[model samples]
Target: MLKRIKPGQARLGMFIEAIEGSWADHPFWRNQFRLDRAKDVERLKSSHATAVIIDTDKGVDVALPIAMTERSSPHPRENLSLKRALRTIEQSKPLITEMFENARIGGTIPVSHAAQAVEHIAACMQDSGKALIEVTRLKARDEYTFLHSIAVSGLVVHLARAVGLDEKMIRDLGMGGLLHDIGKMRVPLKVLNKSAPLNDVEMGQVRLHPSHGYQLLAKQGDVPRVVLDICLHHHERIDGSGYPNGLFDKQISIAVRITSICDVYDALTSARAYKKAWNPRDAARLMLEQEGQFDRRLLMQLFHSLRL
Candidate 1:
């Protein structure tokens, strides 16, 4: 029998359907499926996720227990348990909902206000670390962006604390991470949501977001340059393979360097439409193997930071 899990409870199980991100736009959803109840059941069975979040977007489907989907082959990020995923959804859903409401009202949740929330997200990571880690990591997929931003910011708090950074740096890192991708709001959703691979032209348009984000955040009152720099350079690479500026070592701030590593690590380990999520170990190995691409010493620090 399929398990019905409470919001806070998690478990493991097998998949039955594709969990749709609410941001996913398809004509059949409204025009075709609107009048068909039987179709929904059939579609659900075919897509067959063991547990699904009823009213959310971006990793909203909470799998029952451990979940195993049909393998396209072995993937690095495929270690999520249905239970853990659901537990994450349950634990994270309410917090994200609150953040959304607050953001809509133009209430800025400052970095200082995040301490309690950061601890809570960190605590949730001990078990069911799949969406647990990412929920704390960020959701990023519309109506979910603020929570995603907060999740990234929360990670900065935890990570900064892990490395014994001073309180000011920690706060700066969190705010920077939160606002890092704010530029994407101006980009076209077609490019953001396209299921197919983006061509070079499309990709080029997508890449302009860092500058856009920096400009957007700059207009807001008193945003620290540190945060603005993160918005600008989080895409930069150690070997200069990153976007926008393609800056090299010493050119990027320590904060950008730190946030860059964390951002990429979370993206690799989290589920996405175009790519299966990677496992932490695999993602780490890949990052490690990238060879002179990332700040090794900083990566090491970040790795050790995860132990806390």
Candidate 2:
């Protein structure tokens, strides 16, 4: 049997089935756990959370008076429709971190595993992209690189859906976004995390990441051409003024156009060591002014998709 009780009524032996609050508000990092410590119970009581659900099957149940009479309500985060998507993002982080570490060692990324991760994100995006986007904003400073990958993946999946692409193509684009900056693993950590602006030499090295990422993906060989194109050309411009290859107009593919817009959108809105994050609306507005730097038609589509 399951019972709900106020945090004040929680006991040490109770099996905490769920904490009725936001992840930030909860005393524990995870939703469910055994309330076996006096500190844990006290922590829950002191938190802003109003209630917790307990499973008698797993541990002690609350007293009948409170469990049977007093009502306890679960918070929205506990019952959110996008709960599974939030969980998926948590699960994907370590896997992606390992993939990047492997790449740093000259090992091939596990393509099959990456495809599965993309599919998981796409499924969640199809259901409630707003929740996933909200989840992305909660990432910490050290997690910027990996979570940025996830954010770009979510944004690309959202944009691809808005533009009416088929499921396979969307998954491929999500994969492209996920691995777009894989080459950054090759850049020195000092350069990647410097608090001050980069010198010209460091800036030049930073600019080489696209080609570095392109070459790394190329060596993998089995990566899809669309994915490769996005990895290589997402930084290129429309009016003949972008880098690595400086390819102009029709020279760029639709995949590159879409990925580039989504990539810049995530970067501009994400916090880094050197700059604070831009508000989504402000970031979109700034991108709109870049003129020939981005595809205007696609940018408008992205703005519409974001409901801006």
Candidate 3:
């Protein structure tokens, strides 16, 4: 069983399943570990995490006051819906993380596993689509890269449905969103996570992610063509200004166009190590201001579907 407790309640011998807050604010690299050292406990207590999830089956459990315990419980129906969404994201993280790590090590892409994750995300969106997006937006910096994929997958699934795409295409597009940024795994972490502005050379390396991701997925024989197109051309703009291919309007596919909109929207709204998160309304407004960068009709559809 997993229990959420305040960091001050953490003690030696407990197994931490996760820390709830920005990973940038914590000293530990790994989220899960057995709390054995006193200094580690002190460090966690002093960290920015507001809550910690401990696996009682693996180690000790902490006792909470009656009021605190009661406060954790919400109205059952609402709680279940939100919990279902949150649980799906938590479960999907390791799967996505492992897949990316495997890619980094020159392993094959697990298309079946990734498809299953997309299915799970789609189901959660069915129950609480808005809640799922809300939960994903709170991602910790440490897990941002992996969770961003899941978030984009959910957005793609939502937007695909909004535009009345058939079920098969929706799933395919969702898969595309999940693996669209796989190329970033090949870039150096220093460049991906640098707090300062990237120089021209660093920017060039960052821009190569699409081609890198495209080549990596192209090697996977069974991957769908739509997924391949999205992985490579998502960065391309309709005005022929984007990179790698620089194709003009009509040269880009509808699926790629949608992924590009969601990709940029999520990046804008998400809090990165270098910048604070933008409000949804403000992010949407800013995206609208960027001329020729995205498909206007699709962007408006996304805005309406998300009710932003």
Candidate 3 local distance difference test against the native: 0.82
On the 0 to 100 scale, the lDDT of residue 306 in model 1 is 66
User: Which candidate achieves the best lDDT against the true structure?
Assistant: 3
Residue pairs clashing, model 2: none
Best by TM-score: 3
Q: Is candidate 2 or candidate 3 better by TM-score?
A: 3
Ranking by TM-score: 3, 2, 1
Poorly placed runs, candidate 2 (over 4 Å): 1-79
Between candidates 1 and 3, which one is better according to TM-score? 3
- lDDT scores in order: 0.57, 0.77, 0.82
Off by over 4 Å in 1: 1-59, 63-144
Per-residue lDDT tens digits of candidate 2, residues 120-210? 7887787656666655654455566777788888899888888889988989999999988888888888898798989999989888888
Q: C-alpha displacement of 93 in model 3, angstroms?
A: 2.0
Candidate 1, residues 1-308: lDDT per residue as tens digits? 23343322222221222233343422123321111122343344444233433332322345321234333332444443323433444444455445334433445434333334444444444443444454333243443455455556655666676677887777777667766776666667788777689999989987988887776656656677898899899999888888898798789888988788778877776556577667677888899999757888878776776642
